[model samples]
Target chain A: MTAPSAVGISRTTRPLAPPRRTRRGSRLRYTLTVLAFLLPSALPLLAFTIYPMIGAFWTSLHSWNLIGVMEWVGLENYTTLLTDDATRRVFANTLYYVVGYLPLVYIGGLALALALNSLIPARNLLRGIYFLPVVTSWIVVALVWRWLLNPSVGVVNAMLGGLGIDGPGWWTDPYWAMPSIILASAWKDLGFVMIILLAGLQAIPTDVQEAAMIDGAGRFRRLLNITLPLLSPSTFFVVVISLINGFQVFDQVYAMTGGGPAGSSTVVVQQIYDLTFRYSSAGEASALSWLLFLLVLAVTVIQLIGQRRWVTYA
Target chain B: MPERIRRILLTAVVALGALVMFFPFAWTVSTSLSPGVGLDATPQLIPDDPTLAAYRELFANTPFARVIANSLGLAITTTALQLTTSSLAGYAFSRLAFPGRGLVFGLYLATMMIPIQVLIVPLFVQMRSLGLVDTYLGVLLPGVASAFGVFLLRQAMNSVPRELDEAATIDGAGHFRIFARLVLPLVGPALASLAVFAFMSSWNGFLWPLIILRSEHLQTLPLALAGLQGQYTTQWDVMMAGSVVSVLPMLALYLFAQKYVIQGVAGTGLK
Candidate 1:
């Protein structure tokens, strides 16, 4: 009985020991290697992302300013922001911007990318021209667009006048300011979307298009049936990036309008900035920022969900 | 006849689009060189009297050269740092089998979604605590190890063959040696693209520097240009000159690296 039991134990133990030992060692090495690789970014993320996020949250629950005594205010800041008319209008303006600006940018980018995809002379130059606005600083672009849209002296209105049409006061007028900002922002973001879409277009295998052509499909038919479906992955990418960017639209508005002309162009980010930096209302600003964060997260989640139905990775 | 008409129509449309796209830059240049008050009148394609007065004023009244130098310095240094840090991490992510690697990378990607504006207050606080405010290092440090850069380079590195690494290893090379001798040379184009991207982003950065920098001497070109616009009213020529100064370096870089730049943009989906 002892000999039989010992033989069974030895047979079982020999097979298991090597794999278990190797697994433990490999896991340990992998953990160390990953940590080593991540150290640089991890440190900053902790300092800048995690710590600040936590600090901002804590600050949002208090009434504190630079060089002032801190006082805990509970949820008063949140409640006040919810009821305030000015704050409400800022949120509305941001929503209006998101609704108005995203379509122009996305559609314009897609059209341009498609058009550019066809063999054209000076395609490189054309791509450069389209992308120029993107590399230019927002401050400079804002200033230049402002100059170009100046009611009396601007070239844009001058061109309209050449056609015997009137152009609105783009920046000064309350009614036209948000639209003007949107136009400028769209121009800036157009190149970005074009690049993404172009990448998508390039990734679509030529065989599919050839097959469609062999099947007697016209160019439009091919694009509608094959290219568009295949390009959905990139399109989905553009949609997600654009939506996230649209929510964080700040620089152009800040530089050009400053949420002026009866606060028509006021966006939530601008309001958060003003509250925290300008007015020293850290608590309220933090609340507003968190709200903005939640909105962005929700939109991102929606896009992710939609992507399953629409996006074709290959 | 119909085909000719279609070709002509397409050409005309494209030409018109190009002109519209380029008109603003042309106008800015024309206005910058215009002699006097004429620029403030109805904008024109050609300046009535092209003069260098604005350029003279731009250099005279402001630290225009210094501001440009500061921008170049920050951009170059940041790009260099980003390339080194991101490439190492990218290599590790691509080749090394590390525990929690997927979880760590996912966390890194998640940081990309966090709106930068949310970080401003806390970043400012942290920088102030470290006494880094008003310094170039402060502006450059936080951005050196970009998650996007790491992700991008890692994606690029994945395309490189494993045989090369194995060959180098068999030749008595260590991990770092194999990386330096074998991997670095193969991914040169990708690295170049990343460098250009990193440079442009750093050069055009506004809000972060605007918040951190207070001293006039230390201000970047955008901040300086904004200040110039605010200080002088109706000095369109001078302002335009400042704008040209700010844009010229970028234009020069773009013209020189047109091929690589386009390839980079097309490959990376960078704006």
Candidate 2:
């Protein structure tokens, strides 16, 4: 992609300058060239990403709605959101979603990936099948799951009735709504995690496994000792991505429950959306969004710190 | 004898797992074909009397066709622009020895780490100010210069040898000529993979489109599908039919290019 003559241009341009040392001149030219390459991307990043983030932090300090005159609250928004009962409940619900979602997706995805990695004849087809939902939009998946999990005319309840067992109102009932969202999210996400794990499995050298086999190691022993250790990097990637995605769980919850059934499934993102767009409480929404940002930042830093011990890349 | 039995059991287990993984899709197809009330009773494995009424209803009542068209247009346009911009920037980063290169690239990748939610408000405000809100350009603008695309393409471009550029230059090719004639053709596979990822992401995108596209005619498939669910009120057969329409193209693309897609994602070291 690089033109060999471009370096010649740099040399010729430098020679055209005064015979004295042109180190400072070349540095200036280099800086301009870098800016030319970065300007398009940097413009958006500044306008959309960084500026808004700082603006959110600033807005969170005040109490302002869409039309009201700005009233400087001085941390009242944060303090109120931190201590309010509804805010506490919403935070608790978000925790419920994370706790419910992470393990199911992580362990379930790992098991599926492992199972598919075994000596299955149609492994490619199976992998494709498992990964199908990953590429589909979550809205479609959520809609379909809502139908299947419907209490009265749904297939799940129908099957339950056939088995002489009663199925609860999956989306309507308070207790089951969050679990239903978790199951739907897991179904949509499992394929992505499995694909990552399968790639990790394929990267594991065959000689390592063969040597273990020659030493009379059984299937389970080799899996425990050799395979698992080599797969840690991919596992770590899956965990990090899944956790970030789980915490940002908005689309499915929005479509499936709308944070209804008495706000049982009201995740932090939904709260932010409701506050900003629905209620026009931009200040509070900004506060809540900043809170989520900090939480995610803290988690990501912890993961990066933790990665030193586990993640191996060549 | 025990080993032989164990092998058979393993086969059974794998088959069962595959079956369960595929069950929801299969059930969706079956339920779409089945007559009304068939989906509610005992969840029949096979439809007793199949009909195309749901498909008919889907086409007749809603703007399903328009939604499909909008999604295709958005996905294709966004992917094309993304590939062009990212390829240019990626080539520059990999081949050009500009100053502040490290800091610039770092800033680009840093944008990837920030959750897109943090940017929504300003982006919306910016779009509103530009009078681009509720337009196709609005959906396509933010994604055209994607950081992940730049990152992936740069990785691929770095592997391309410098000799190719020198040969083209010696043959009297200019910089743009070398880029188009020599560089781009060599990185065809990488470009194709990036295109696939971009297309899938744009096609499956819901949140941005939902927030931006207010007009009914411009609504994408996912948005349209969500609307169908509410308007129909327990008409799943029709909803499933709409979903099938939405998903079929993606399925076809994925099946045909499964190898490239897998290689592309794996190439990113995302695994």
Candidate 3:
């Protein structure tokens, strides 16, 4: 009953079909109805996602700009990106982002979750206040941070100046630009992680904490041994997500640094944008895009494999 | 005695953290209201002389009003499209007897794993070939078909009792009849949850829209805000005014539907 599919449909084959056989004359109608429902998503998904995935590979092998003649240059794009010093620095900058970005989000989110989990007045209000940033678009977040960190007349440096300390030029200074983006990114996203962790915290039964308390475990000890161990699954979830997001960071860098005062904050996606649109290097950009995808895929695969050692599912 | 002191310290720390979280936004609003006195050290939080001159100038200088309308129209269109398609695909996956169900769904979920960064250039080529560049249709198409939304709805649809659909089938009711009548009504809560997510993502989506929408008048809030920032790099007051305008609707929506939004997020992320 399975025909060779032209489009990207599921090639599901049962050795002996039951439903189609039973339906008989109405089988075609049933299939049609299913296709009707499926086609809406399937066509667009194939067009937008599946088609482009294949096209990405094909395009990566050709030296083509948007308007110019397409020339076959398989592996050259990859070679250029891998060997070029500038592109190498772009990869390093991406690594720097993930390295600096994830920890701040995890630590800050966990701390906020832990704090909110405890007895507190205006708890929901406080949670809402904390979550306010999460919903704000990254463009807005980047703009806000740019203003706040604008050295000459910004609020942050002004506060630092008031404290009798000179503040460094945040987004302008190559050294501080990435760290500044990390802080802003973490702040904007920490609320989502906090909410997820808070859900985990809530799921941990109060009796477990009580049992630990009655067994002569102090607050810190309980948190270290019992609380954190139980919170592993959620923590693992948050970490994986944080890493993925941290690696693919584009908006903040695009808005705040524009790959910046000597390319300090140039993340991979930013480079891809610059390559594709600015430099009109579609083939090289696609290659870079795939490499970024590979890095994310590799990291995620590694996390999945490694989580077996530490992440307790139950 | 120490426990009390610990609570006090924890409370103080959390409060300070909240201030840090909120200070930028508060200052944005404050700045948006204040006229451009030009840049100076230690800008006033209360803006001793508050004015809406920045807000006025934001509208007067650019197509800020048209940008807002564009954002609203696109967000609503994308949300509607996603909901309909996701719910339909979700229903077929959950209730229908289909071959390769496992394989197809697996492929669909894997798309979620791939970051959108990978798709930008090739997707752009496809759009350009289709002659849809710099159009709302191009911006709306990519986001409207979401695999995660389908997966979420399928799970929601699974909890729906099969007996009801079976009875309907026995009553000679078709898939559409059962789906449109029985299944959808039962899955209202799930639909609502997905709507909030779909709406927010479309509204806040920056990268794809920024790539596709080249024209200024076609720009959504996020893109317009980006353009606005590019134009007025040093006009903190007007930029803040635009920032305030862009962020307020979302903040209000989240507050209005706080429980649904949070629960929706928690459900998706935890799963």
What lDDT would candidate 2 get against the real structure? 0.79
Question: What order do you get sorting by DockQ, best first?
Answer: 3, 2, 1
Tell me the lDDT of model 2 at B127.
80
**Cα lDDT tens digits for candidate 1, A1-314:** 01122233335443111112235565455346445666766777667777888887787788878547779998888898889998889888988998998899888888888877776667777878888887788888988888888888888898898899999988889999999999888888788788889988988889989988899999789888899989887777777777888888888887788888778898988898888789988778887888788889999999889888877767
* Tens digit per residue, CA lDDT, model 3, B103-172: 8888888888877789999999888999899999999989878998899889998999888877787797
For each candidate, what's the DockQ?
Answer: 0.40, 0.43, 0.60
Q: Given the true complex, what DockQ would model 1 score? A: 0.40
Docking class of 2: acceptable
After superposition, the stretches of candidate 3 with alpha carbons farther than 4 Å from their true spots are A1-23, B1-5
Query: Each candidate's lDDT (Cα)?
Result: 0.79, 0.79, 0.85
Q: What is the clash count for each candidate, in the order shown?
A: 1, 0, 1
lDDT for each residue of candidate 2 in A16-99, tens digit (9 for 90 to 100)? 121233466654554465556556666655766777677777777777774567688888888889988878888788889889
Kindly report the docking quality category of candidate 1: acceptable
lDDT of 2 by residue, B1-271 (tens): 9977876787777678778777778878877887574344534668878899999888889888888999999999988878887877887777665445679789888778777665555466568878998999888877877888888888887788878877766686655676678777888888888888899989988778877789999999988988986898767788888878898998888888888787775555452
Residue-by-residue lDDT tens digits, candidate 3, A1-314: 55323222323423112243344456676677778888899888888898898888888999998788889997999999999997889889988988988888889899999999999877898899888888888899999899888888988888899899999999999999998998888889888999999998888888989988999998789999988988888998888888888888898898898889789889889999999999999999999988888888998899999998887655
